[model samples]
Target: MKLSLGEIADRFDLSLKGDPAIEISNLASIDQAVHGDLVFLFNSSHRKHLTDTKASAVVMREIDCTDCQIPYLISERPRLTWANVAKLFDPLPMQAATRHPSAIVSDQAIIGAGVSMGPHSVISAGAVIGDGSTIGAGSFVGEGSKIGEHCRVFPNVTLYHMVCLGDRVTIHSGAVIGADGFGFEPNKGAFVKIPQIRGVVIGDDVEIGAGTTIDRGALCDTVVEDGVKIDNQVQIGHATRIGGDTIISGCTAIAGSTRIGRNCWIGGAVGIIDNIEITDQVEVTAMSLVTQSITVRGRYSSGTGLMRGRDWKRNIAAFKRLSNLFKRVRKLESERGD
Candidate 1:
């Protein structure tokens, strides 16, 4: 899949600084790039390595091209241009339209045209699978589930009963949607299990990563709005409503009944407490412990930065005595009367 620099520049709308006839076939990092490989310089930290790269073509900002000797593609956003160019050589594999004999599709299920059902895939009674959807091996779509057009349910994925997914939704391998949420009632020292009766509703163009578990609601439907991107191993609790276009990173645990607003970016390993309301456009930094509701739309961080172990212990001790120290300082200030 080699393409000349001229073709790449024309396709990506970038300006070519060197020989446009030079051909590049693959993409690599600046440090490991070889002949016929395409490399890119995006961060200023990698500027020093550009001069020594052996790549046939380099995608870089116009300002960083002074010492670069290779055939270069100049762009305002080099990283974006490099990504678009890389897609030309690395295209997604197209799945063939076929239903394996081992697949168990119920007679009551309505399957659309061009759908591919792999081995051991099960579509339960009253399930509707839309056109061009591919259900991978061992995937199960429970009864009354509605999967929209062009959805891809990867291997071992499970959609429980009554789960509704809109068009172009992609659930990666080992994802479990519509699972029972953690709901219990305290009855005088014994915990009583509360029956989970609601379903999960996922909107269009949502891509859920591998091993992510989205719990079903206790009484109301758990909703994930359009264009929401959830990373791997995330735990989305029951009755939660995630607004449109929100991006949640890996290992994030969102508690039940929480309402997360639109376009919010939740970083990795963030723990959001139950029943909390986070407004739109909020950014939660990685490893943050969100213990309270965030009504304002702003970036919030709670995790402490890395430090020497001894220094961290000292800082923690100091932080604990801050109230007493503040009182002493106030008394000293009163005596000085300055």
Candidate 2:
């Protein structure tokens, strides 16, 4: 879909700074953009490339418009504006209402109007799929599960029994919802299996990335609130509650019964311990290990950046000696008359 600079600015409520007639067909980075393509500049460090870029139109902040050679759209947040405009060119695929011949849909399942069942998909008994939802090829909607309106269960995704998903939820390929949590009891020198009786509850507009696993609760529901974005390979443990608008990056492990507050940003590879409460608006840096509850809203980090093995060993030795060194200093101070 091609649009002139004027049309784009009008649609996105941005201000046009250059020739409004210039047309743009696609979006690209500043370094890779060419004529007829649109590009965006967000960081001030990349401003030097603006003079040499050949993009027909650029989306940027009003302050960065100076000396720019191309027709541009000025916005307060250029990156977000670029995302909104890019959607105009790349729309989501429309699924047809018909079910494929190879799809196996149980007669006991309650499927709503306009639902699409792709080839080899399975809809089990007592399942309820809401209006306009799409079950992609090879996907499985387990028995008694309830999926809400306009949801997309991508190819090879699995929704286990009793799982509930709200409207517009998207589960990407290879995601497994309602999987059993890791639970066990010691019995006579051996580990005994503990029953996992609860399910998963996902709210509206949540997107679970590929290969992510959301475990079923041991006794109560594991909940993911509205607008939560969970990246690939994330593990959400049983009975955990993640608040609205929280963004958790890839490879993060959230242990059981944890309560994460609203609008929190959890970076990649973070490990959050069980039963901890993280306050609202907290930011957990990448690779940090959270061992206790955080009551304050602030940036919390606990991990060492890259360092040489020899230097790291020396730093650890120094850290171990600090307690004795402090004791010696205190003793000397106490003995001094002044």
Candidate 3:
């Protein structure tokens, strides 16, 4: 996809400082771009490359436009403008409706127009696939499940019984939604399984990454509200209700019955204990362990930061002296008796 610098500037409403006739054929980094390619310099640290870059045009802020001979599209938000320009090149694929002969679709299933069911995919009895939705190769749509219009369920995804996906939802490969929740009781020295009776309800425009697992609820549905972005290899436990626009990063494990409020940011590798209620706009840093409910909106973190091995050992030793120090301080205060 080729776009002229003038066209891009006019469309994005950015001020142009270079020749308007220059054609941009591709996008590249400031260091990697050659002539006819578009590049970006959003960080001040990379400003050194401004004069040396071979890019035909650069997307940059007005301040960085100094001492540069090349043409540039000045944007207050260069990164955001660069994203818009990139979309002009790499647009989403619009595939025609296709259903392979190898697909196994039940007669009772309802499939709308412009649907694509790939080879060996299964549409169970009473399943409803909305228009313009694509079920990838070998994916399984469970009985009575509903997939909304324009939803994309990639290969090997398993949507268990009665799961509901809203419009524009994207589920990546190997994601298992509506799986059984980890619920059991210790009865007579044996663990008895509690029934996972409810399904998963995902809202519109939500994107679930690969290898993620969202468990089915015990009684009520496990609800993921609209515009939530979930990263790869994440496991969300059953009965968890995630509010709108929350971002969950990779390798995070949220325990069962947790209620996460809107716009929260959960970092990678974080471990949250079950039955917790985290309020809106809370941000948890990477690798932290959350043990209780977070009621206030703020950045929360646990786990020690990285340090030298000797320093870490010394810090651990110092913690052991805290109890003794408290006792001595208490005795001294009692003797003073003010």
lDDT of 2 by residue, 1-338 (tens): 88988898889898888888888888888888888999988998899987788788888887888887777788999878877887798867879998999999999999999999999999999999999999999999999999999999999999999899999999999999999998999999999988899999999999999999999998999999999999999999999999999999999999999999999999999999999999999999999999999999999999789899999999999999999999999999889943
- Look at candidate 2 and tell me the lDDT of residue 100: 98
TM-scores for candidates 1 onward, in order:
0.92, 0.94, 0.94
Spell out the clash pairs found in candidate 2. Answer: none
Total clashes in model 1, counting residue pairs 3 or more apart in sequence or in different chains = 0
Local distance difference test values of all predictions, in order: 0.94, 0.93, 0.94
lDDT string for model 1 (19-61, tens) is 8889888999999999999898888788888788888988888
For candidate 3, write residues 1-338 as lDDT tens digits.
88899999999999998789999999999888898999988898898876788889888888878877888899989889878888888856765799999999999999999999999999999999999999999999999999999999998999999899999999999999999999999999999999999999999999999999999999889999999999999999999999999999999999999999999999999999999999999999999999999999999999999999999999999899989989999999999994
Give candidate 2's TM-score. Answer: 0.94
Let me know the TM-score candidate 3 reaches against the reference structure: 0.94
List where candidate 3 sits over 4 angstroms from the true fold: 91-93, 336-338
User: Given candidate 1, what's the lDDT at residue 333?
Assistant: 96
